[model samples]
Target: MSMYNEKVIQAFMSPKNVGAMENPDGVGEVGNPRCGDVMKIYLRVRDDRIEDIRFETFGCAAAIATSSTATEMVKGRTIEEALKLTNRDVAEALGGLPPEKIHCSLLAEEGIRAAIEDYRRRRQGLPPLPPRHDAVCHHEIPETGEETRE
Candidate 1:
């Protein structure tokens, strides 16, 4: 049986917001050396909400799909709301991913958080975070302290 669901396939096949944004309010990048997957998220903020969002993911189908869906989920959301978006939420929105591929969702969550962090830093005149090789799956619980994978 195929591991990917219909929603996953659809998202992967025709991902939305799957490109770089010019003059973005913030940008964040992450990568995984083991799998050689890289992801960069861009944000355009208005007031306290995410006016727009985009992503560039170089990875598997799951990775692309998650990135696409994650951006859609947070496109018009407030920073606080977007910060609360979880990997599980992304997975669930896509009707769930395979056990082994759930990490892709984590990567999406990480990408979102990273981009927002950069935005906050820029707003505060602080330096952006150094590039970190912590993209796909660190397999650690998020700040919400809730387990994401099923």
Candidate 2:
């Protein structure tokens, strides 16, 4: 827990834009079974720019902090700029995360990508993509509750 820096702690303690948006232009949700973390990102786009962004994250402190930072990074930027955001960028903005918790930053990046993809698809009159569940560093349990390794 001490692995978190002051930036991480501050963001976690006072997360920004942490909520759902009504009638959002795009929405993305991603979950990691390994850490039991779930993140949802909503976007309001106007004139090809992200006019507003919000996120809902259910995970550790790192997850929440990363979510907060990621939104701040891309807000008021073009969709293309938002897509440029990487997991490493999120981690660096937070000063850094513990080795085990670095996946949280990845989740934040994925969430942003998902949301942008959704926005683009909608603009093209395409269908929304299925929710994404990317298990990072954890194997999925089968119906029998067993982890099978080939």
Candidate 3:
């Protein structure tokens, strides 16, 4: 049987917010070297809320689905609210992902956080933060059913 659920397939096949934004308020790119999956997220924030969000992912179906769903999940949310979005939430929104593929959801979560941080930094006239490689390596494996640390 296919490991992916209907929701996952639907999202993967018809990913929302799949393109880059022009003059985005913030941008974040993350990758998993282990699997060679890369994802980039763009954000446009207004009044402390995410007015628009988009993503481009070069990865497996799970990665694409998570990226697409993550954009839907964060749009119209306050930056603080977006920060609270979790990998589990992304997975849950897609019904679920295979244990081994759960990391894709983490990528989505980190991408959104990184993008929001970038926006905050730019708004404050600060330089962009360094690229993040820790999102995958340091993150607790979400498939273990462990609660991730912020």
Candidate 4:
């Protein structure tokens, strides 16, 4: 077997919080089909702080390790603190990721932010996050195959 960084191998081999929560206050799932990586995060919060976090992932070793590390980093942290977590942090915590697998760290970052957002919206009685305007596909034609501007 090829040698791997001890930290990365440790994280991948013995991931922390590596299960689903029974009743999570917030859940976030993100997948990158391009790379065949998917991550699902579950969190339980109290007093606007994360009390518990868990994750299930279907991806490469780096992806799994990132998700596992992210779960441990966020628990017991306030929403604000958790949001401050960056992809760099997770990668660094894991002793760094290979260039080819960097996107896995990004997915980990997105998963954490997404989970935090879900928890905030639920706690504040707010609605789901608004979709970005650019994400909308307006197929309606205005006149003679011309697209209409919203």
Residue-by-residue lDDT tens digits, candidate 1, 1-150: 337888999999999997889999988787675775678999999998999999999888988999999999999999999999998899999987776676778888988899999999999999886666763556433444343333
Runs off by more than 4 Å, candidate 1: 135-150
Per-residue lDDT tens digits of candidate 4, residues 1-150? 224477878999999998889978888777644446778888888988999999989888878888998888888999889999987788777776665566677778888887778777877898654322222222222233221111
Please give the lDDT score at residue 55 for candidate 3.
94
Colliding pairs, model 4: none
lDDT at 148, model 1 = 31
Model 2: lowest-lDDT 10 consecutive positions = 141-150
**lDDT (0 to 1) per candidate:** 0.85, 0.84, 0.84, 0.75
**What TM-score does candidate 4 reach?**
0.79
For model 3, residues 1-150, the per-residue Cα lDDT tens digits are: 337888899999999998989999999988765666778899998999999999989888988999999999999999999999998899888877777677789899989988988998999999986666544453334545543321
The ten-residue window of minimal lDDT in model 4 covers: 141-150
List the candidate 2 regions with Cα displacement exceeding 4 Å: 135-150
